[model samples]
Target: NRALYRAKFDAVTARLSATLDTVTPPAGFYLWPKTPVSDTVFARGLLEKTNVAVLPGSYLGREVDGINPGANHVRLALVATLEETLEAADRIADFMAQCYSA
Candidate 1:
């Protein structure tokens, strides 16, 4: 099951790579992407405009010792079907273009 998820995750990341700054997911059903803007802004804007929800990186971990390692990133869960994940990725790319154009 893990291998299957990883394969799907890889396919999603490969498609998103052209627009999003994504690292190869280590494990689990999430993709941790470093967005061009603040994580909160990126997450909110995408959610509001494209209806693609993402978990802000800051929420995944604590600001340990006043240092937030996840401040500029967001998490995208690939727990849905492949088609849904791919569609969400496309929406995210469109949202990013809209945001950067202005």
Candidate 2:
């Protein structure tokens, strides 16, 4: 499990390096990256465009003082097989390039 997590983590972080602010936790099976758009919008668009599902970070947080800490983030799970994880990362990278590239 650790090996799988490391591989998926490296692949995803490298793939998204140019497009998102990927937050690396000390140890986990998830990656929470700041999205260029609304987390809900990004998650929906990613699913619609790439068939890759992600949890909108907003779904994991509550609004505090009129600000949602996760309003602009998305959570990516690294629980798939290595091949699927790689494919998802590629699709996400491509999606980011198409929709959020500068």
Candidate 3:
């Protein structure tokens, strides 16, 4: 299970790196990728277009002085199977490519 998870995580991270910046956490089930737009907007569009749901990073953190550190990111949970995670990453890359290509 650990090897499976690491392979899935690495594949997804590589796929998403084409468009969104991702940090390789020392250990975690979630990927925090920086979005090109507002995190909420990005999350909504991703769900609507690709049928992939992610938590807007803003929802995971508290606002400090009207600034949410996670406002420009989204949290992608790689808890699915390897195939599913890869598919999600492809969809995300395609969606973001189209978004910024325009």
Candidate 4:
């Protein structure tokens, strides 16, 4: 059972890594990371606004509540087409810029 799990994990990881390598974010933003994780409000917002999806860091057990888990970052799946990903990146960059400016 473990062997099967490992095999599937390895195959998915390898394919995901290879996919991430070829992706390019807009001009300012970048991929969160090449890992399997969960989605967050911020990530969800991006998906809703730009039709691009991302996993939030909290979803990866980084910012769990009621249990201090230290610093945990999220991994994003940038498996969308170049155009869609770029659009999403642009939207995210703009949103972040506005948030910081405020």
Candidate number of the best lDDT = 2
lDDT, model 1: 0.85
Ranking by TM-score: 2, 3, 1, 4
Kindly report the root-mean-square deviation of model 1 from the true structure over all alpha carbons. 1.8
Give the per-residue lDDT of model 2 (tens digit) for 75-96.
Answer: 8999989899889999999998
Clashing pairs in 1: none
Q: Lowest summed-lDDT stretch of 10 residues in model 1?
A: 93-102
Candidate 4 lDDT, 13-62, residue by residue in tens: 34434323223333322344432222355566556765656555555453
What is the per-residue lDDT of model 3 for residues 1-102, given as tens digits with 9 covering 90 to 100?
777778877898888787888877878788899888899999999999999999999999899999999899999999988888899999999998887755
Off by more than 4 A, model 2? none
| TM-score per candidate, chains pooled | 0.88, 0.94, 0.94, 0.42
User: Per-prediction count of colliding residue pairs?
Assistant: 0, 0, 0, 0
Residue 65, candidate 4: Cα error in Å is: 12
Tens digits of per-residue lDDT for model 1, 1-102: 887788778887787787788877576788898888889998999999999999999888789899888888998988888788889988987887777644
Pairs clashing in candidate 3?
Answer: none
Whole-model lDDT, candidate 3? 0.88
Question: What value of lDDT does candidate 2 attain over all alpha carbons?
Answer: 0.90
Candidate 4 C-alpha error for residue 7, in Å: 27
